[model samples]
Structure formats: structure tokens, C-alpha cells
Target: MASNVQVLADSWIHLLLNLLGYGTIIIPGYFLIKYIKNSQYIERAGNGIFSRIILTCVYGNTYDKIVEDTIQAQKPRKERSSFSDCSQLIFCFLGLQVSYLTWGVLQEKIMTEEYTDLSGSIARFKDSQFLVFVNRILAFLLAGTYLMVTRQSRHKAPLYKYSYCSFSNIMSSWCQYEALKYVSFPTQVLAKASKIIPTMIMGKIVSGKKYEYYEYLTAVLISMGMTLFLLTSSETHKQSAAATTVSGVIILIGYMAFDSFTSNWQGELFTQYKMSSVQMMCGVNLFSCLFTSVSLLQQGTYFTSIEFMFRYPRFFWDCIILSICSASGQLFIYYTISCFGPVVFVIIMTIRQGLAILLSCIIYMHPLTLTQVVGVLVVFGAIFLRIYCSHRIKQINARRAAGIDSAKV
Candidate 1:
């Protein structure tokens, strides 16, 4: 059985390499279509042979779909209790879960593998930094290709326009991986779950906007839950608890601080530029790839990592899978936020994180202390409470508005 699984894995690696090598033939054709789409005489020249072929093969119904979707988004959409909406929600939920789980599993597998006997170069290159670098580059390439194919560029600003957000995002991702070495995955997640607190604080500082009472309460609950979880975690790892906590706290502090700004920055960009999710993703990742590339070179691991990858093809395969999952996960997140409101999006993500913790414990056989369970429950309760409070507020406001209208009548 083990041999069969190994063979299957090897087959996949080979297939991925072949696909990567041969995928460039369509590049020229893609750029040609993009140029034609951007040209003012496109309609008049539609009868030309080259234009006809490009329109048939690439544009066809896609052109109409993009225009219709953009127009629909601009208008006030009427909410409908429809089967299609339900199906879309279900589909997005499943896709997000699978993509996220797959990325996490692949990362853990790569990091925890038997690298002790490997050469120093191979060991060093297998760190979270390398993984993140490769993932960002892949995502950038994919996003660029998407733009070329669609002939769309919503934000024409320089790449540096997104540099700060991209840098913070990449750093947050790196810190998540770094913290994994000191704390268990569940512990790392619990630490990240406290991001709501810092995010609220940062949002207020950045935008000078006050949050609702429920938002503040929710943030407080999450902070308390994380504190409880950390306290219990120390008790479990009594011997090394001090060192682990110090290191984990440092890493997680960086992660949370950077993460708190990322959402706000992205929101600012969207509001200012009216950029689509793909445009935002492409811009951020393109700059992130540049930043990561510089870091890898500065650390002098770029060549060594390539050498290591050549020696162990499986490592390369895992990185490729990680990249694909990261890209897909981002798109799924954007799609969910666009289709559903942010509240539904947050609820869906909360569920995803809960499942991730559960699955990590099951697969890794990590002990979830009773206190930790309570912490999880507390965090989840806060989320549910926020949802209930929001609903109640909306109801009260609606009734008050109706009363005012009746008085005016």
C-alpha cells in the first residue's frame, strides 16, 4: 500500500512538471487578444481573419459575461431567496475548505518531514520563507495570466502602490509559519484568532471610525479566549513553556500587527480605485513576489534552494501544490465576499478555522486539553453572539422606522 501511494505521488509530480514546461505556447495569443480588446477599432475590425479567430476562441461569450457582471455589480442588486444563491454559497464554502485544508496539510508535511539527515542547504531552504516565496511567485504569474486573458487592468497605478500591503501580508504569512515551530497548529490558530482585537484598534486609529458595541464585545471575547488558551498551553508544556511562549509571542505579535493593517489597506485601495478582486490580488502578489525574491537572494538561499529542489523532486511538487492551493483559496475568499455579505463571509471563515483546528488535532494527535476546549467554545460563542446582536439591532431599527412612518401618516 505504501509503495502504491508513493508511485501515485511520483506520477503526479512528473505530470505537473510537464504541464509547467509546455504551458507557454498560449502566451503570445493571449497578449494578442488583450491588445485587440484594448484597441478602439476592435468592433470595426471584428471581420478580419485574425480578429475573428481570437474572438471565437477566447472572447466569445466571456466578453459579454464580464460586461454583464460588471453592470450588475454596479446596480443595487435585489436580494432573492433562490436556489442558485444557495448552491453558490454551498459551492464556495466547500471550495474554500478544501483549498485551505490542502494548503495546510501540504505545508505541515513539507516542514515536518525527515529533514534531519538531509544536507544543510536542503534543510535551510525548506523553511517557511522559501515556501511563501514560491507560493507568491506562482500566484503572481497566475494572476498576470488571468489579466492578460481577460484583457482587464482596473488599477493602472505603479506596482509600488500596493507595496506596503503586500509586504505586510507576506510578513504575516511568514510569521504564521515561524510560529508553527514553537507552538502547535491549534495554538498558532488561537493566537491568530485574537486578530480581531488589533484589527478593531487599528481600524479606529486609521479611519477614526467607532465600532458598534457588539464589535468591541466580540473582540474582547476573542482576546480572553486566546489568553485562556495560552495559559493552559503553558501548563501542558511546563518544561519548555517559557522559551516556547516567548518565541511564539514574538512571532504572533508580528503576525497580528501586520495582519491588522492588511484588510484596512485592501479596503482603502478598493474604495479608491474600484479595483476588482483579481486586480487587487495581482497587484499585491506581484510586489510580494519581488520582495520575497530579494529576501531569498539576500539570504543567499536562492541557488541552494534550487539545488535542493533538483535533488528532491517531491519537495518541488509540494511547493507547486502549495502555490496552486494558495491562489485558489484567495479567489474563493474573494468570491464568497462578493456573493455574500461580509458577515456571512466571516461566519464561513470562523467555521473553516474551527474545522482546521479539529482536523489538525485529529491528524497530528495533539492533545486538546479541557481548558483549550473551553477556550475554543468561548471564541465561537463570541462570534455567534456578534451575529445575534447584529440581527437584533437591525430588527429594532426597522421597527423604529416603521413607527416613525406610521406617525407621519
Candidate 2:
């Protein structure tokens, strides 16, 4: 029914689509689990397996740093704590990973019900999505209020800090997910992949990070990888090329902007709130659930989502798993950023993209072409370029320090 070129393109495009969809769900997730392992604060929340060891270390540093800087109250990093704290990190990481493993099924469930949630609410409230969105906001507001009251002895303005970080999540997810509804899978991946550029840009602009020429070179290589995949891919008549590209770009930009701001924002949380990592996580999700709910309800999507969720309980459960995994992952992500900073985190995230591309073809039972393989390799090369540069800088710094010490001697 189709020409060889068209069929080849279709098959290849399908492969890309799986990459985009799965990658979108997976990359951020791995970092989150990794983040939890790295966070001393979360590990210290209780007496358990991981909490006793890792939590003590994470929080010990956390407490020492925040106390020294903010309050001029000094505490040693190795001070012994009666409570064991590492189990929280263990549970958090395990819970997040389990969720990620089940994400495909859960996401499928959410996809079916999510739109109805927004559209259904429209009849009762002219801005029904907005109303439910408000309720979801109320949920997080409740968390913020409770934390502020309960933790009042610590510091003021956590509400403000959490508000900024959480608020960014609401905006970023809304824009990116909304745009995702209209685009193809591969388009989404490339667009999302392009985020390395804007993130690099924002990191330079807002975070005062510099980019090397290799980083630029890496970007070009990744772009080529994507372009090859795209060229070998077929188009959906659902939209024009321009429209699709624009939407993908918007998604990429939104992801980049919010993620950059949020990552930096967390450093403040780790430094200032000094709250347990789990507590910070609960705080963000608590807010996110509220915000997303209100936005959907005001648009009448809330009631619709509910109707479908109830009608398809099984499907809804899937979304529940996905949402929870996603939420927990967010917590891990905060820890990762706090532990390794944005650059390394991005490298890990991008590497996951290549894995996603590889797995999606197999998992989805799609055939990959030689060109598609080439494209994937090219993208990987790009990721390596950025990661190598980022890694090299750390090594260089250590060498420089050694040199300085020798000179001083």
C-alpha cells in the first residue's frame, strides 16, 4: 500500500516514537532514584537499613552546612545521631523504581483518562479544570501550611521557596504535557532532547556556568542524530511540519526553563529548609497535585477525568502508579541535583535517552533500520561530548588544586 521509502520511514518513525515516549518517562526517573541514594538528608529520616548509614551522612552535611551559613550555629558533619535514617532513602528509591518499571502501563491508563478529567469538569464550572486545579492547589497548600506550623522552629519562608519550585513544576508539566497531546512520539523525543541546549544556555545565564566548544560540538552531533532519525521517519497528517516542530520546541523550552529554575531552587531548599529529603518531596507533590487538579477542573476536564477514572478503575490504577512513581522520582531528582549539580544530572538523563531509544524498538516490537541505528549512535556521541566535557572539568579542577598545593610548598 505504500512505497518503500514511505514504509521505511513509517517503521523508522515508529521506533523514534517509542524512544520519545519511553525516554520522556524514563530519563528523569533514573536520576530520581540515583538522587535518593546520594542524599544524606533523606537517609537520616528514620532508623532502618539505609537511613542509619546514608541518611546520617547526607543530613549530617546538610545540618552542618545550613547551620553554619544561615544561623552561624555550628555543628560537625560527623556528630552521632541516636536515630537511624538510611531506610527512608532505601524505601524512596525502591518505591520510585518500581513505579518506573510499571510506568508504561500506568501511562497508558493516564492517557485514556487525563483528557476526560479536564473536559468533564467544564459543564459544572465554566472553568472546571481551573476549579479542580484549585482544589489540587489546596492539597499542596495544606502541606505547606502544616509544614510551616510544625517546622516553625527551623526557618521562615520555606513556603516561599517551595512555592517557587513547585510552581515551576505546575507550569512546566502543563505546557509540556499539553503540547505532547498534539505531536508524534519521535518529534517529542528530539524536541525534548534539544533541551540540552536551552538548559546549557540557562545554566550559563542564570547559574553562571560556562560552556566549552566541545559542548557546542556535542549539540551539533545530537542534532544530527535526531535529524537522521527524523529523515528516516514518517510524518502524521494530523499536523503540518511547522506546527509539529513548533509544539515540540515549546515542550523542550518549557522543560528546560522550569527544570533549570527548579534544579537551582532545590540547592536553596537543601541549604535552607534542611528538611528531610522525603519531606521536601512530599511538599512538592502535595503542591503539584493541587495545582494540576485545579487547572484541569477549571477547564471542565476534572469531572471528565473523574468519570473515566471511575469507569476504568484498572486504568486509573495504572495512572496512579505512574503518578506516584513520577512523584517519588521528583524527590530523587532533587537529591541528585543537590549532590551532583545540573551538568552531571543532565548527562545521566541524556544517556537514558539512548537506552530508551534502544529498548523502545524491542519493547514495542518495532523493527529498526540501519539509518535509525546510525541516528541513535550520533545522538549518543553528542551526549558523550557533553558528559566528557563536564566530567573533564572536575578532573581538571582537581589537578589544578594539586598544582597549586605543590607551588605553595
Candidate 3:
């Protein structure tokens, strides 16, 4: 009887332990399902404490009418006056030029210049990730401030969508900076000018958009010109030849791919959400800061970068100014894309690229070969030809639309 009792007691204890283990797993799984369902319910109902917290924390607005406002924003709105449109375009173009021109100069200075540390040792700021983090965090702050000041339509897009854009954007910028260590600024600028092809490729992939025959032709011309320019480097340009290594070419290719994706994705979001430029900026930069901060922390360079900043006052100020320019440039970028569409924005940026190359050559005295000059002219010619053809296409479409309207009348 005693042996039977002992066996039964042991079996009961084993059964209890098994039940406890199962309970631990089942309870959390049940709660997770309930939590997700509750969140979905809140989204559909557009009310409740959870929804209020999301609106306030994510959007910086706690007004009870946010859902209604978002719905109303989706409705068709009146067009702006032609004069207002022109003025906004002027502001966007000028803002982009001034802000990015300064940004380029400062970027080169920061990456290339040597500064004295507190220990009296000369060091260059090698933390490109830190620079990225600083730029993004400041842009986030500025964009948030703008959104708070100006009344914007309630944003309805899922916040996580911005992460896709932010990741590509950060990678592209990091590539740009890192490539400076490998290539001349002119080379980099010209390489970026060749992004038209990549943009079309990404457009097709991301948005399933089709292109014209002329676009393909221009893309080929641009590629040929780029190859010619890269191959025909001036013999005297030892630094240029030495810097334009295979690694530099690889990094630039990555930049083009990532940047093309970024622009296309952002444009899609604008079309889908009809969100304001500041709202887009705020959303993208918020995720940008989050990703970069986590990266910097994991790499253990966050505090070291801060210490480096304190050691060199000029570098610190340069970073601040760089961040300001970057923030301002971002606002212009989104506004231009939202207003005139990505094609017009790309045209403006292409022009800026040409000017940026010229500016870098003049200030930094980067030597250009005769072939390089011809190559540049060829590339620009192709670009301008593509632009002209695009313009004619638009005109033809407009005329056809007018004809259809007149016939209907």
C-alpha cells in the first residue's frame, strides 16, 4: 500500500509540473492574440484609449476628431492659384540649391579635413554613421516642430511604412559619405547624375511603371558617357585616379540603387496617402533617427563621437550647420516632390548635380581631362534631350486631353 501511494504521489507531481509549463506558453499566446485583435478593432472603430495613445504619441495630436479629419483629407480639394504654384516652385528650387550646395561643401570638409583633439592629436572625423544620426535627429526635430506649428491633415498611413524609406535613405547617404573617402567629389556628383537609369529601373520595380523608348536611349547614352569619363582620368590627377578604385565604383552603384528606391518609395507614399511634405519628412526622419541611434549604440561609437565633437569646436559647429542644411534640404525635397512630382524634382536635382560638380572643381581644384569634359557634355546632352522629349510628350498629352474635352462639349 505504501509503495502504491508513493508512485501515485510522484505521478501527480509530474502532472502538475507539465500543466504549469503548458500554462506559461498558452497564457501569453492568448494575450498576444487578444492584443492584436483589440488593436485592429480600435483601428476600425477609430476610438478607445489605445487609439488615443497612438495618435498622441505617434502623431503628436490627441484631438478626438483625428479620424474624421483624416477621412475628410481624402476628399478632393480645390486647386491653388497659378501664382501660388509658381511661388512655391521658386521657393523649392532656391531652397534646394542653397541648402544642398552648402551641405556638399560642409560634407567634404568634415570628412576630409583634420582637426586637433583635446590631447593635441590631429584626427579626422571617421564616424559617418554618427554624422548620419546627427543629421536625421535634427531633421526629425525640425519636421516635428513644423508639423506642430502648421495645421496638417491627420496622417492615416501606418507609421511602420516610413521605415522602408528611411532605411534606404540612410544607406544611400552613408554610401555617399563613405565614397568620398574613395572618390573625388566631381566623380561622385557625375555618378549620381547617372541615377536617371536607376530611377527608371526602381520605378518599374517598385511602382510597376512603364518607360518610353527615349528614356532607354538616354540611359544608355548616360552610361556610355560615365564610362568614358571614368576611364579618361587626367594623368596628372594622381589622387583622382588612385581614389576611383573598384571599391568606390561598387559603393557608388549601391548609392544609386538605394537612392533610386528611396525616391520612388517616397513618391508612392505621397500618391497613396496625400500627406503633406512636412508630415512625410517627420515620419521618415523619426524612423531614421531610431535606426541610426540603435546602430551607433550597438557599434559602441555613440559616446566616442560625442567626445570627439567636444574636442574639436569647429568640427562640432560644422556638424550643427550640416544638420541644419540637411534638415532644410529635406523639407524642400519632399515639398518639391509633392508639388511638381518626382520628374520635375529630378530635373532640378540633375541641374544641381552639374552645378555641384562645377562648384567642387572650382573650390577644391579637382582636375578634369579633356575627355572628361567631353564626357560631361555628352551626359548632359543626353539628359537634356531626355528632358526635352519628356516635355514634348506632356504637351501632346495635354493637347489630346483638350481635344477630347472640346469634342465632348
The clash count of every prediction, one per candidate, is 0, 52, 0
**All candidates: CA RMSD in angstroms?**
11.6, 13.7, 13.4
Give lDDT: candidate 2, residue 192. Answer: 53
Model 2, CA-based lDDT: 0.54
Off by over 4 Å in 3: 1-39, 43-49, 53-94, 117-122, 176-193, 222-253, 343-353, 360-373
Position 168, candidate 3: lDDT: 84
Sort by lDDT, top down from the best: 3, 1, 2
Order the candidate numbers by TM-score, best to worst: 3, 1, 2
Candidate 3, residues 133-237, lDDT tens digits: the string is 899899999889888898887776666568778878877776665565556655764676567777878888988878889978987777667656655544223
TM-scores of all candidate predictions against the true structure: 0.65, 0.58, 0.73
lDDT of 2 by residue, 111-202 (tens): 44433343344121122223224334444454466666675344322332355677675556555555565456656656655655666666
Error of 1 at 137 (Å): 1.4
Task: Sum up the clashes in candidate 1.
Answer: 0
**Collision pairs in model 1:** none
Q: Better model by TM-score, 1 or 3? A: 3
